[model samples]
Target: MSAPLLQVNGLVKRFGGLVAVNGVDFSVAQGEIVGLLGPNGSGKTTVINLISGALPPTAGSVALQGQALTGLPAFRVARAGVARTFQLVRVLGSMDCVENVQAGLAFGTQNLPQRASRAQALKLLERVGMADFAHTTASELTYINQKRLELARALALRPRLLLLDEWLSGLNPSELVDGIALLRSLREEGITMLMVEHVMEAIRALCDRCVIMNAGSRIADGPPAAALAEPAVVRAYLGDDDA
Candidate 1:
């Protein structure tokens, strides 16, 4: 809708004659949260990779604010105002929380030393409620803290579109609530987000719209309540598993 801030059309990805994502299409608009849901191997991560430019699609089109992004590299994509986070929370194990976030900031900058200063890094940590953990070693932090660190890092890019993969995987109920609030605040700040998640409550609470993928293709697309109630969606991704 409204000429999506980021658009993926007929996206296809293959590996050794095996198709991972098959003609999938989706879009994320300015200030909206869209959920991408599917079971394991349903092509959620593959689709995110195509959008984030970590992997190229075999045939399809990706557009950012209506401009073609088909051939851009990952950094180029980030420069275009799209940021992605890994499902496993990629942080520097040796670096402190602040430093980990600073590395991410430097990524979208035009010019910066390979390393960032502690002050700059702390500022990012502050944004994610991690300022107190500024000096905490990544490996020393708990699982939820690491996820917050990942969010701080991603925010360093000041992206218009944020791609998140399984961001809620290991969070406790309270952590999920806090993380969802952070995402909502980002959306209010006009950041568009597309997330691939299995947490039903998070999806229902956070997303304005939903896209359900089955067999590498879209099977349902609509408001969360509507999509969740669809017959195909129940059978494929949200059925008895939710009940």
Candidate 2:
């Protein structure tokens, strides 16, 4: 069999005396949507940071398609075909929707020219259901629209691996439905994703497999139902009595 598209081996992170992530290991295959699930402070986001080059790992390694990505700066990682969205929506605020995505296109791996970048940015905005808001300043958008805008920017990178850090949180039921559908569509378009999310509904709907973390370490990895049902996962989310 061919190798996985992304390989993370023995990943570790430290902040002073705190071990935010400990020897966490997982992989994302080509054209797969894998959910990274855990309770608050379970080190899910830390793992994302480690992989995305937002934070250098204290140990272990990250490789993309056999190319070592460990120790690269975040920009280098992006140029290497990895893009990510933050848990807190990040946008150019000063720039309008189209320009925000255009920024991504310009800096992304493709680095399209001015006219082409704008054209591609608009298409991406439309894909994320923000066509009408193409000229709207990012700061003026509602929370959900900002999320959409962030996603559009990430797509501008034309990444092989997309890391979504709670990109679907804070949505109502209706918005959640739309969010899940949008992600499913992206998966169909062949974007491999590793998402850190607490939304069980989206996890079950979008993930082919899940890697569950607890207190900075991986406790389970398997299909959503099977992984989430693991005794250790259950205990991590619920106390011993509940487990």
Candidate 3:
């Protein structure tokens, strides 16, 4: 097998007395969608932030294709082909959907010309199923549409790796189905993803593997079926009657 697309080794993050993420190690292969699963405060988000350079790790390293990214700032990480969406969707509220995506295209890995950026942004919006809302101001979008807009903006980065934080959190049944379909399409295009998601059905449908965490440490790393079935995972996340 080829080397993993992303490698994180002995990753650690501490905020004062709190060890938010303990020595986590995982690797994601090219084009694979890996689920980062855990209950609340399991440090899943902290792990994501550390990998993406939103927060520097207290110790250890993160590398992509053997290139170190551990201590780089967030913009440096983005320029290195890592793009992420937040748990709480973030967009330029005053800008129209298309313009919001344009900002990404302008400052993303590859800087595009203004006209080309505009056109490409529209295509990205189309990819996320938000083309019809291109002219709408971001503040006008509903919660799900805001999520789609965030996806479009992230895609504008033309990333090799995508980090999605609870992208499926608030969808109704229909929207959830559509969201799943959208993610599958991205996977088909060979986009690698490490998703921090609570939706079990989405995890089962989309993740080729899962890494489960608890109390800031990794507890299980394997296929979702086997990992989710682990007694420790059940006790930590799925709720054990014995506890």
Candidate 4:
């Protein structure tokens, strides 16, 4: 593969006496939908927080498209071709759905006028299948549609790389199926994707490669079939078989 689109070398994060993330290295190459999976408290979200600049790294470096992003503010990091959707959906409760999307469109942009257009917001919502609820408030939307709205917001930046964090945290069987399909579609549209997911089935279906982390460090990395079945991964997350 050519050079990675995002390179995280020896990444570390510390909080006072606690070491939230240890020296971990990982990379996402161009056009790949990579899955980051682990048990709870395994530092998956912390890694996203570090990459998005929500928290500064205590050690190591993060490079995006061959450009270093050391100590840059979260908004600045986001403006630099990286966008992320949180596991928690945050929409303006008072505003209509389109307006909530408009808000995400303005996220990490210098020219708000260009991103906050009705046509563009509609297109974004349509892409995520939330166009029918475009006129409803955040509080009025069903839980599934709210999640879809958040996805539309993330795509508003025309991001080169999108980080999806727990996007399928809560959903019915149908919702999970549709959500996975929609996320897979982003790759077809030429968007590189990195996802932190819990659903084994979803990750297995959507990701071309999988990286497993444990205790703030890399335990395995390979294609989903190869990586997930690794003894270390199965032992650490999936639990080992009895002797």
The predictions' CA RMSDs to the true structure, in order, are 2.5, 0.8, 1.1, 1.8
Give me the runs in candidate 3 sitting further than 4 Å from their true place.
238-243
* Clash count, candidate 4: 0
Tell me the lDDT of model 2 at 73.
Answer: 98
Q: Which stretches of candidate 2 lie over 4 Å from their true place?
A: none
The local lDDT score (0 to 100) that residue 101 gets in candidate 4 is 75
User: Which residue pairs show collisions in model 3?
Assistant: none
lDDT for model 2: 0.94
lDDT against the true structure, per candidate, is: 0.85, 0.94, 0.93, 0.86
- Estimate, for each residue in 15-80, the C-alpha lDDT of model 4 and write its tens digit: 898887899888999899999988888899999999988899999999998999867898888889
Indicate the TM-score of model 3.
0.98
How high a TM-score does candidate 2 get? 0.98
User: Against the true structure, candidate 3 has what lDDT?
Assistant: 0.93
Please report the candidate that would top lDDT against the real structure. 2
Pick by TM-score: 1 or 3, better one: 3
Worst 10 residues of 1 by lDDT: 109-118
- The Cα RMSD of model 1 versus the native structure comes to 2.5
For model 3, give the RMSD to the true fold: 1.1
| TM match of model 4 to true structure | 0.94
Cα-lDDT of candidate 4: 0.86
Is candidate 2 or 3 superior in lDDT?
2
